[model samples]
Target: MKNLILLHGALGHSSNFEPYESFLSQHFNVHKVLFHGHGGSEIPAAGLSIELYVEQLQQYLEQQELNDIYVFGYSMGGYVAMCHALQYPGKITSILTLATKLNWTIEGAAKEVKMLEPELIESKVPRYAAQLMTLHGENHWKQLLPAIATLMTRLAVKPLLTQTQYESLNLPVQMMVGDKDAMVSIDETLFATKNIPNANFAVLPDTKHPIEMARPELLIGLMKDFWKI
Candidate 1:
């Protein structure tokens, strides 16, 4: 059986993949990876960049001798996946990304960082705020916010993945975005698919960001089709 590695988005942990475990495990060896400073793994106070996350993932694959596998990355994790594919060709069998932003610029990134406002989340989305706090330590969630903002700010200056790089990656890649995803634009998602050599794009209707929670069935269907399981 082929191995299926699930990479969670920023501010999320391996637990985010629990919903897909049972279903995907029946078809392949499903593995959920927690990026550095996420889940119960060692937390880096300064947080991690996409490159660092790629290195950690590479080491994990090496330790398990998982040279070839399917990598499904969500949001930030997807950016990491593209970097990994570019750096280590022939190592990844395929890549699937959902709700991953493909465009970045310093000004745009800085504006996005504003949404990470602490008071806003704690006030508007208290449930999510509570979850973040639980995922991180009691008050460590706030610390993670600034670190994430810093990474985004840096990405604006230098993105982890670029159009030229995406066009050069020979491996198959499938990117999906929700129809109502306000965070990531459909145009950019389509742009990525068009640049990649063997890539496909899907727009999930009646869905929004976080497809895992918005429409898990559609996500599973896409995976089944992509992997042909």
Candidate 2:
């Protein structure tokens, strides 16, 4: 059986993959990873950059003595997974991403924030604060804005991958985005998959950026099939 390493989106813990855990366990050994600062893991708040996250993932894999695993990442987790595959092409067998964003342009930033606003506005302040706490603990509310700001403002340092980088990947790569994903454009997702030499791109109908609620089974099935577990 294949070993599947699952990654969750920002501010989300490994439990986010709870629904698929049992099903995936039946087919493959599953490890639902908890990113630093989430799930009571000891990681700093400010060092939550993409590179840091990638390093943490590598360490985790080493500690667990894992190899030849398939990776399934959602949203921000997807970004990490893509970078991982790019950096360590030989380690990954197959990669699958759901609602992953590739490039970040000036216009893309506007659209990204615009899409997030509605969720922030409609959300209950305390509930949202609690969710932040889940990821950042006691200083959740106070640190939320700064953390988000850092993600937006500091993103320029991390340039988007070129077409050559994506096509250079030797393993199969698959990306899925919800048709109704307000946070990321379908065109953006399409553009990402296009350059990948061994890539399959799919759109889930009536789905959203936070696809946890829309179609968990579809996500699970895609991973299982792609990994052939």
State the TM-score for model 2.
Answer: 0.85
Worst 10 residues of 2 by lDDT: 113-122
**Taking the tens digit of each residue's C-alpha lDDT, what string does model 1 give over 128-229?**
889888887677778777778888888888886778898888998999988999889999999989999899999989888864556678788988899888
Error of 1 at 47 (Å): 3.9
Runs with alpha carbons beyond 4 Å of true place in candidate 1:
none
Candidate 2 per-residue lDDT over residues 189-229, each given as its tens digit: 88878888888998888898764565777776776677665
Deviation of model 1 at 113, angstroms: 1.2
Instruction: Report lDDT (Cα) of residue 169, candidate 1.
Output: 87
Q: lDDT score of model 2?
A: 0.73
Residue-level lDDT for 47 in candidate 1: 68
**Candidates' TM-scores?**
0.94, 0.85
C-alpha lDDT score of every prediction, in listed order: 0.84, 0.73
